[model samples]
Target: MRGGPYLLLLVAGTLGVGRGLDGQLGSPCHPSGRCNVRFSECQDNICRCSGTGVPSAYNNRCLPVADGLKGYCEENVQCTVPHSHCRRFSKECECVEGYVMARDRSVCLPVSRLGEPCLERAQCKESTECSPSLGVCVCRGISYEYDGKCVTDHISNNWELTVVTVSPAAGSQLLAHNRWLLCIALAALVHAGVR
Candidate 1:
């Protein structure tokens, strides 16, 4: 049999497929369809996809949903359950990093990322935890909050927090400079009074 002429995209939870020797989704086919594959087959003269079967978006073949299978969770989480990610060559429910299942475990939420409200540490983003007192995510231990991100004292990656330090010598010089300016101002005032 020859390859069909259409490409198909299998979406979440839906059997989206159709292909025949020359039959594409919604195309005409004979009662005794010439081609058959796991994802699709001749049915009522129409090609169709069934559970877990996907048709090639680039070819006229039936394939399985691989990692490209999108994770169905809020905040781009890539899993169905909390604190997990998608596995390889297969579709799996996963939550995005820095997210966790809700208190009811009904869904995932982005509790990671500082400043987000969180019920528990598992929900907060990496290196952060939910503050029981403040009731929001904050940096853990030595890390601190900066620019909406949790970072170490020596943070890098173009987000470094600059710390200003002055030695005793620098402090004395600044004080001397201020004193000289004050003396100069007083001298000017005396000169004006004399005039």
Candidate 2:
């Protein structure tokens, strides 16, 4: 009977001592990045970060970039460019010149998806591809190379590059269009040294 009491006391003491040492009672430091308001615990069962880009912590846990956005990022695998938000249409994260993050985490989406049609190579879906381009899935081609293999280029001209630039007027909307023409014009002026 004395042995049973001693065993119970020992167990209770051990538990009490652990509670004192940890000081949380049961709430430990939750991972910042790992928690999305749904699950806040890092210990028992939590989703681990796994993405090609650099791992980042939000709540307390490290998070990897989301899938389908593999090599289009520089820092946070989810982002194509630094500080840029991931585009759902292209699956590439790019920062538009003027847009900022909204309360719902929505980023600025340009008309590029509507103007230029790209499917398969650039990760653009078939139905989403723009017209006249007859955007169709094809083998990875020219502009971008994946895994030592060059992805296919649906656009025939390399002169076509979509760049988002802020308009001159104050509070003017940003435009996503061909930057090649501007570069060429600038180059011509530079060569001629126009005033």
Candidate 3:
């Protein structure tokens, strides 16, 4: 009877018919077979997939994980999208340098175009400014000004025209200055004629 019980236990163990002595469930998949797919692993004796899990995404069985920019992931490998990386603390995908999170917070988009609304300079395209007053992207430099609709400039050809409103006293001073210049020019001409 003692031998019989031992033989029964041995057979059960060989066949994997019940829990092991440690009271743990046997793994359904072989150790080598487990984690066969990318970003997949045997967790709690079960094969679990990671990442976005899109069709034919991983190992041809589990869904593919999203890329780092927009997908939720636990590891970098789980991110399948380009220019993306996994954030360990957040367990989410994020964009790399030179990319920005879209307004939807799902995908990484390029910086804003000219005249597009923006919250930060990084959100705008290169050499552009996020207009603080209008909250829109605009060209850099003092030449550009935000009108009601679009950005405008005053430069024409190589010369820049500047219009300024002057008080009465300033206007008279400018007129006198011009007159003095004219008189000086006439004197120079007379002196040249005598020479």
On lDDT, the candidate that comes out on top is: 3
CA lDDT of each prediction against the hidden true structure: 0.56, 0.39, 0.58
Using TM-score as the measure, the top candidate is 1
Which regions of candidate 2 fall more than 4 Å away from where they truly are? Answer: 1-27, 30-62, 66-77, 99-195
Ranking by TM-score: 1, 3, 2
Residues 1-195, model 2: lDDT tens digits: 779999998887655431212322123333332323232233433333333323332433333455332324323445633346655566555555543332233433332332243432333332233233466333222234334333333233333334456558622322225466566755655544443
The residue-by-residue lDDT of candidate 1 on 1-195, one tens digit each, is 233322222242123223354444444445565335456756686666556555554335555443322443222223324455554454454555555656655566775558878777777766888899998888999888777777764323433233458799986786687988656555555544522
TM-score for each predicted model, relative to the true structure: 0.36, 0.20, 0.34
Q: How many clashes does each candidate structure show, in the order listed? A: 9, 16, 8
In terms of lDDT, model 1 sits at: 0.56
lDDT of 3 by residue, 1-195 (tens): 679999988896655422222322222433434444445555555445554453242224554565446566766666665666778788778877767876666556556767887876768775577888999888876435444233332222223233579999988897787988656555555544522
- In candidate 1, where is summed lDDT lowest over 10 consecutive residues? 5-14
Return whichever of 1 and 3 wins on TM-score. Answer: 1
